[model samples]
Target: MVSEAQLRTIIAEAVPTIDAAKLPADVAFADSGIDSLDYAAILLALQERHGLVVPDEDLSRTASIAGILAYAAEHRSDA
Candidate 1:
């Protein structure tokens, strides 16, 4: 169970220049100014941090913070 704080920290590290406070937890990544490269970077970061490999298909479908959170939760054991 990744806490909200952890998620925020991840986003902060991924996009240091962005004002994460203005971003909603359930908002889509596209609407949050996260481009494809940023998304790929995030997926890599998650893999390095949690030792879990997120599939490309899953990454494609994860458009929102909430969606990512749910995916992480479901794959917690793998992490």
Candidate 2:
């Protein structure tokens, strides 16, 4: 099973500027320098990693790493 820590690593890799070890889950993507295009790229990478399709509406609900972790926890098939 991919733990939240692992997910954090994946996310950090997607957004290279954000330091995963120091970032709290509640930190907003915008505050962390993750713009819309970066967010889209992160989503694409996450979808490929987790094998899950995130609808646009569903993606709208997530604005932080915590949100993505929650979505992955709920939808990841590899779990």
Candidate 3:
């Protein structure tokens, strides 16, 4: 089970400008100081590292940390 702490590391790696650990779980990435490009990088990292893939159509569903966790819980595959 992935935790918020782990996600914060991913976020920090994806965007080194901000303190990912301090970011709000409910805040959307765009509203939490993450730009589109950084958000994309974070998503890609999630896919590559954790196998959590967010398709184009469901992009809106995973805009925040909470949303990402929920999506990962629902869709993540260990295969």
lDDT of 1 by residue, 1-79 (tens): 5655666777788888787666797888888898888777777777787665778767655566788778878888976
Off by over 4 Å in 2: 76-79
Q: Name the Cα RMSD for model 1.
A: 1.6
What TM-score would each prediction reach against the true structure? 0.83, 0.78, 0.90
Q: After superposition, how far is residue 53 of candidate 2 from its true place, in Å?
A: 1.9
lDDT of 3 at 62: 87
What is the overall TM-score of model 1 with all chains considered together? 0.83
Please give the CA lDDT of all the candidate structures: 0.75, 0.74, 0.86
The sequence of per-residue lDDT tens digits that candidate 2 reaches over residues 1-79 is 3466776777788778877767778888888878898788777776676665678888765678788777767766644
User: Local error of candidate 2 at 78, Å?
Assistant: 7.6
In candidate 3 the C-alpha lDDT for residue 42 amounts to 89
Once model 3 is optimally superposed onto the true structure by TM-score, how far is the C-alpha of residue 77 displaced, in angstroms?
2.6
Best-to-worst order by TM-score is 3, 1, 2
Over the full model, what C-alpha lDDT does candidate 3 score relative to the true structure? 0.86
Error of 1 at 63 (Å): 2.1
Q: Give the top-scoring candidate (TM-score).
A: 3
Top lDDT prediction, candidate number: 3
lDDT of 3 by residue, 8-74 (tens): 8999998899989889999999998899999899888887878777889999998999989888887
In model 3, where do residues sit more than 4 Å from their true spots? none
